[model samples]
Target: MREDFLLLNPGPVPLAREVRTAMSEPMVSHRSAEFESVYERAQNSLDYIFERSSLDGTKTTSGGTSLVFNGTATMAMEAAVANLAGEGDEVVTVVNGKFGRRFKRIADRYANVTPVEFDWGHPVEPEAVAEAVSDDTKVVTMVHNETSTGLLNPVAEVGEIAEEHDAYFVVDGVTSLGGDEFLVDEWNVDVAVTDAQKCLAAPPGTSAMYATPRAQEAFDGEKAPFYEDLDWHLRKAESHQTPFTSAVPLFRGLAVAVENIEEEGMQERISRHRSQSRAFRAAFMAMGLSMFPEKNDESEYSNTLTAISLPAGVRENPDAFFDAVTDRSVSISGGQAHLGGEIFRVSNMGNLSSEQILRGVRAIGEAFHEAGEDVDLEAGMAAAREQLR
Candidate 1:
């Protein structure tokens, strides 16, 4: 409750005071031993948050490694495809939301991409993905959390299908990792990418990827140009260094963010997110606001964020709703692409508290009223409280 500003967006989430303080610490040379110590600590923390014992991508071992890139998660997504897909390699990409479409778009640039598309709010069916993957398919890409619509895709099932077809499974876990439940190796995912922002509650401009030995095999073929090359990353990772000048301050912030997560415990962190999401959804539903995502069950719903259809009156004057919310010192997100003005997203990611969510819901309810909508704020608050209780 900073009172000055509150972020409810999926990315660039509200950082903890400690994480922000870590970023303010004096910068160190990327090649210095001090930086190496920081790098080693970060890697160890990331492995724990990623639930991997090791970095080599094996689920059974505790010594797996993850690549920390000084860029957005989108860069990690691109790197995953660039290293795993090449000329004549068929890539089966699941497209159910904005991020999913992004994976397809990225894959299309380097491989024969077969996109299994769904509506913006609909979940990607694993059965359809199974049908899309062929013997010639070299990679399968998916977004674990469809952030745009707050829908969770069946990544575990799709991973099984990809493994059955002997294809490398790459996941865009930008918004899901650290906040949601994800098992990289158990799900047979060959590569999974996530950023320092979003669920990690750290500053942006830094991303990480967990790649297995099998996924690394794709680098044998035509590799991406120097910057996107995973081979160079792996070679440099041995010494806790990056091939290029690393974002030292970002590393410090991310390491502290991961430390905060460790202090809270992953299961407890995930549970908090789930409870807040459920409370928000329940409150909104009680206020007669429908969810934008077309989920068949709770499992298909995202715990990091919740997307709600725009109120009828607000849809006609969406800016009023957004502006009203912002005026209340709470910053949320609007729908993207074709869904713009049709829905609004509220994130409960990072270190948000029950009081914060309660206040956010009330503010949005007030915004609904400001937009000339008939919403029962009392009912919504009551419902949210019940869920939180």
Candidate 2:
């Protein structure tokens, strides 16, 4: 990382050098025995990481499985929808943020998609989800942490509904897994999807989705469009392989990454993310910053990323603030598309230390000053430190 570039973005935040080095090894053939062994390790590692039945999800290590879909978090998503839902099958998708909306668009190509959209910063109601699950509801999807608006949806409740109705519960844990509290088996999720770039502390190309037995059962007989074919992937996945090749380096890198989490413990990592996130929020509140999500309790507050309403005038010219922070070597981002110019999303995914918190607050306070808003950097930083401590 350059002294001028500090990655505070929600995705692709910052990766440890060890994982990156593993990804930088010599390339090998997908069909090679060495590759199969490498593939098996990754599948096993991901199964544990995603909490896959203590022995589930795709155990495949072949082609690009390690990388989160060709450098974007979207591919893993496409894979999940295509592999799980079939043509004309109605899927109820929650659209509370950009990510959820993106899922809707992706589903439109393969299934009969029914979108349950809510206010930009609003949380999806469990009751609403229950009501939305019509008889034809074969699949239900939502982003646990809607990175677009930084809202967390109710996965547990949604999962329960899926259990009651026998529908597949597909959760986009892209911004939550590895950094937030998620239970694959206990939650009863059919297809739990996530990208390594977000909170897994891996590079952008690696993402994963854990399939419960029910999800696997649903995959059979339902032939999806080619490329997103779940059947083909599963056949290969069953043998700890893939239908196509994967980025070998991320496969290796992700294994090390998952090993790190295993050694440190998943709950411990969740606590770290929660603590840092709580501190970040408290500090923002003390500085008179307003949280967009409104409620942080059971609503959609995420520990990995939090969205805030940009202060007045700053939204008019976000660059002044963005540039000021960039000058300080901290990188934050605005929302996506329609919501972009109004909200600012701050992430503590990777490489965010308690020391970095001080620097981030200082940069934000200084930016407000540059934008002609009086601010107390010390007070914000102090509150943040206290929250962490």
Candidate 3:
């Protein structure tokens, strides 16, 4: 723990030194008023981050209040889904990546879930979303940025279409939000979900959603079982409390992370991500590797994760490739199931910079070299550094 490890994986990435220090802090009693103040400040600070871009929801809840922390982002997704869709109402689920498919699976467990799936590496078409909606449709769920493929579904367009159909629009912004632009209000997004892990640069365990008054009103119509109930969270959150104890260290880390993001300035932060991403892509291309996403649709590109397609006839070996990078003391991820072995997804968003990007490119070259492939790693490194410039 004395020396920092570079995290180029999709998540739980290398945090800023400050974040590590925050996480190093000792625990405080969850019930204490001082704890509530920390919780309250955290909530308010995040509201400023997610909602500040628009004139909407700025109330922050700390101590796992503004955000539902101490759990994976899955908890936020399930809570939002279970509360909004009800037992019998219908919803549209767009699946392109592993996470998207996972969301569909979560929905299938519920009563009236209709999945609108697209081919892997393909974006969800607006028409497909339109076709999936039915008279019974109560909600529309889609992943804003498909981390598995680095292809973004047009959540803004999808949001408009869903709203036009009078359906509640719920989006999973897990890997996209902080690194790029998102519209929770103008897009008329009733439910917006994201975790602090990826683009947020905060530690894991803190996940949150933006629930509009309309979304809240709909949830008010029925009683949710136990902790799945947003009403319970609302009731307790209004009083600055959570139904259970939370990860105090994680919250402290997030508080600092959010401040760091603000200090960097959102646009500049996004630009930095774009710069590193561009450089990373250039380096890959120099090595004859291509991204799963196409160029024209780069607007739909994800800033957090880049899914690189395997080189032709190379016979994909994600494990081998990832191991190459890890051998260099940094970590990059392989694709999840279905995409596994076919694509190597590298993370860019976070506290990472051009220096890490340089190191990462060199690692990939080392891997190619070990594989006995004739690769110009120097060229890849040069291209990457140039793009960063």
Candidate 4:
């Protein structure tokens, strides 16, 4: 297949040349000494990203051991819960969007679930979480960034609430860990999951999770489903290995991606993502497109993706809205679940530059016009330029 369109979807984002080259190298043996070096390097990167100095499993709250699963972020999310929340234990889930709802679904299968749901496009309030947790609540699961609605939840505030209640906090940080600012230890995140495809700027084959020592207490001799078990993963990860045969190529790609992230510096990478998101938001607002989320302030906005409603005429024909934009060689995303066809999501993650964002805004403007919506392309571009500057 020939690649042509500019991929602006959240995960499986456009990869860096170095990461691609690393993946393109010859196949490697997962058991070889060479692979062990690669595995350690990746673990070191994960450590830095999780804000831990080591993974020696010494500290109760900050023992930063990360497990890389040979599956998608969904698998890691399940592991984080399955390993902690067992039968008879109550689990609290914050459902503000699709991904948050997924935590409730997964938790339902393993334990008693108490869902604290919010409006689809609104952020989860800390007070609501405080009200949900109790003595029987074993886990409190939340999404750091609700990718479905482009709403950033109050992770820190909720983390503190969980701590006060002595409930384990499991966070789905897939879209925020690398692109946005996150501190597993500082935020009291007991278990957090992230993917290689989203902000990590790599292909999707493996996902990683950070588990603190206190979280390890959830193990009750009974384990989760075979492949998703964190006990088996931690046992193998001690030797810089996985329980099953791993995808060596994706590991190589991820290692390089982590190196590139280190070179760019975490703060610089976060600032870049923020700038890109600001530019995209400014352009959309200038073109008279309101965000799907009704935000009173910027605190609830996601820096990785923006969910914007289509213009009046364009909303009448959702397919035409998508087709017109794809016809211009730009690949953004439509909303998911109940939000389907109502809003479009634009991701500013991975290796995207200012020029690509400008082009994307232009393509969207063209698509709006093509769909018979009267849009001010010049005004949108000007607003974007101001933010980018």
* Deviation from truth (RMSD, Å), model 2: 4.1
Question: Candidate 1: what lDDT?
Answer: 0.85
Roughly what TM-score does model 4 have, to 2 decimal places?
Answer: 0.95
| lDDT tens per residue, model 1, 236-263 | 8889999899999999898888888878
TM-score each candidate. 0.95, 0.90, 0.92, 0.95
* Predictions: Cα RMSD each: 2.8, 4.1, 3.3, 3.2
lDDT (C-alpha) at residue 387 in model 1: 83
- At residue 175, candidate 1 shows an lDDT of 85
Give the TM-score comparing model 3 with the true structure, all chains together.
Answer: 0.92
- Candidate 2 deviant stretches above 4 angstroms: 1-4, 52-72, 296-299
Clashing pairs in 4: none
Candidate 3 C-alpha lDDT tens digits along 181-255: 666766768877888888888888888776777888787425444666788777776756677786778877887
Candidate 4 whole-model C-alpha lDDT, 0 to 1: 0.85
Q: Which window of ten consecutive residues has the lowest lDDT sum in model 4?
A: 52-61
In the range 193-305, model 4's lDDT, one tens digit per residue, is 99999998878998988888888666542558887777778888999998889899999889888777767767777888899999999998999889987677986899999
Candidate with better lDDT, 3 vs 4: 4
* Count of clashes in candidate 1: 11
